[model samples]
Target: MRLAFSLFVAGFVTLAAPVAAQSPDPVAPVKEVMDVTVTNWSDSVDEWKGIFEGDRLNRLYTKELVELYKKASEKAAKIFESEEPVDPFDYDVVTNSQDGCPLQDVKIALAGEKDGVSDVAVSFRLWACEDNADTKNLVSEVHFDVVQEDGKAVIRDIHHVADGERDSVIEELKAIIAQEE
Candidate 1:
């Protein structure tokens, strides 16, 4: 019995060792996507400094987010034209603060993802050239929610961090859209 048990344990380890060695890191693909998006976006933002604030702000978000904002902006414009009582959407949702914005003086770090109950949180970081009242040089850890959309991985929401507080881009969009009626 002892001999039989010892052989089974040895065989299990042998099989498991090779499988573990061959398996690629599950988080590697997530990191790659985050790196490309975050790094490229940072480069673009820095390159376009001193341009119109609107243009700069538009450049910092994903295409889906940009489109969503554009729609809301159109609605808000109509409201303003008609002299509405309340603003349809808070424009600060993207930047996470009323007046503050994201400035990427350096490339953002693409950290690994944390598995959540409903979605995955891909970690990232941004930095400033100098620390100020709003941001540290290293800023803080930011998280983007990755969801499988149409069989491909796309960021559905951003947990935006500005002025040291976290906010959600998708939640803000929902709130703005809900106010339409």
Candidate 2:
């Protein structure tokens, strides 16, 4: 469909042969992002908050989460700052404070786990903004994939799914694969 649309546009431009090569470039191609409307995002809010702000967040990771975080952290440390978000590929949590806009809603859909692999769907209202402050609904579908490690109930492989954010929780993976008990 995209190819067909581009061909049609080209045909029209050629048939209408503009008089000036200097004519301001025709309307620029608009980049479109998704608009998400999320509700009941509060449940994850606490979880997220704890993960971000909690000093001992690692302690709650049913064992598996700890490993995942460690692996992810290790991979991330090789590339980004420790304080930066674990999911560095555009991973951000929205705030409730914003202009007169719709409430910040993030609808998270979690898939059951089996054989150490689980899927989570994050449906939310991504508020469009000039900066991170203008918060407005702009995205609708967000998904995450998690993998469990041996003898652990936590997730080690954290994949956002939307973007190729394949990062292992550094410390966790190291603990598992590292030598010398």
Candidate 3:
């Protein structure tokens, strides 16, 4: 009985070792952001506010991106205090639009790694909650640059394409900050 129990324990340890030693998925942060975006599509104000102001900002985004976002937010706040208040980001940065529907056929994959950063490709079709919505015009794609930070994967930048126009979140944020200054 003692020998049998010892063998069982050893087998359990061996089986668990591989699972415990697996590396973190580089695409996890991208998937998480997409999931949150889709799930909170109806509550854009609070959801985005939480992502920008709460701990999720630091947990999911790189330091440089976070700094840029903070600067933009500060500038927006200052403008809000002025006589003519204007929203710096009129559209949702993630979707690159002011309107979005529930996501369907969502796909997230780690495309490749370059210079220690991983490229994550995300594509989805907008489900308008209709039985016969045109799916062709509702497709969207975004790419995320992720890097290891503190031994965890975090998003460094986001690239969005819409209507044959290319946009980078980092570049947009910098442009917004520069335009105001």
After superposition, which runs of candidate 3 have C-alpha atoms over 4 Å from their true positions? 1-22, 42-50, 82-88, 127-137, 163-165
Residue 82 lDDT, candidate 1, scale 0-100: 57
* Model 1: residues with Cα > 4 Å off, grouped in runs: 1-74, 80-127, 131-138, 161-166
| TM of each candidate vs. truth | 0.41, 0.35, 0.75
Alpha-carbon lDDT of model 1 = 0.47
lDDT, model 1, position 39: 38
Instruction: Report each candidate's C-alpha RMSD, comma-separated, in the order given.
Output: 9.9, 18.7, 4.3
The Cα local distance difference test for each model comes to 0.47, 0.40, 0.77
**lDDT tens readout by residue for model 2, 86-106:** 442223322222232333454
Candidate 1 lDDT tens digits, 31-136:
5544444433453444422211355334433457656655655566675675433334443322333332334432233345555212334433343443573544
* Residue 165 local lDDT, model 2: 44
Worst 10 residues of 1 by lDDT: 48-57
Q: Which digits, one per residue and each the tens of the lDDT, describe model 3 over residues 1-181?
A: 9999999999999987766555568888887788777776653446344345467789899999988888777677676775443346777667776666766678899889999989998888765565665754477888899998878889989988778776788887888788654
Model 3 lDDT at residue 128: 52
Winner on TM-score (1 vs 2): 1
* Rank by TM-score (best first): 3, 1, 2
Q: In model 2, where is the ten-residue run with the lowest total lDDT?
A: 25-34
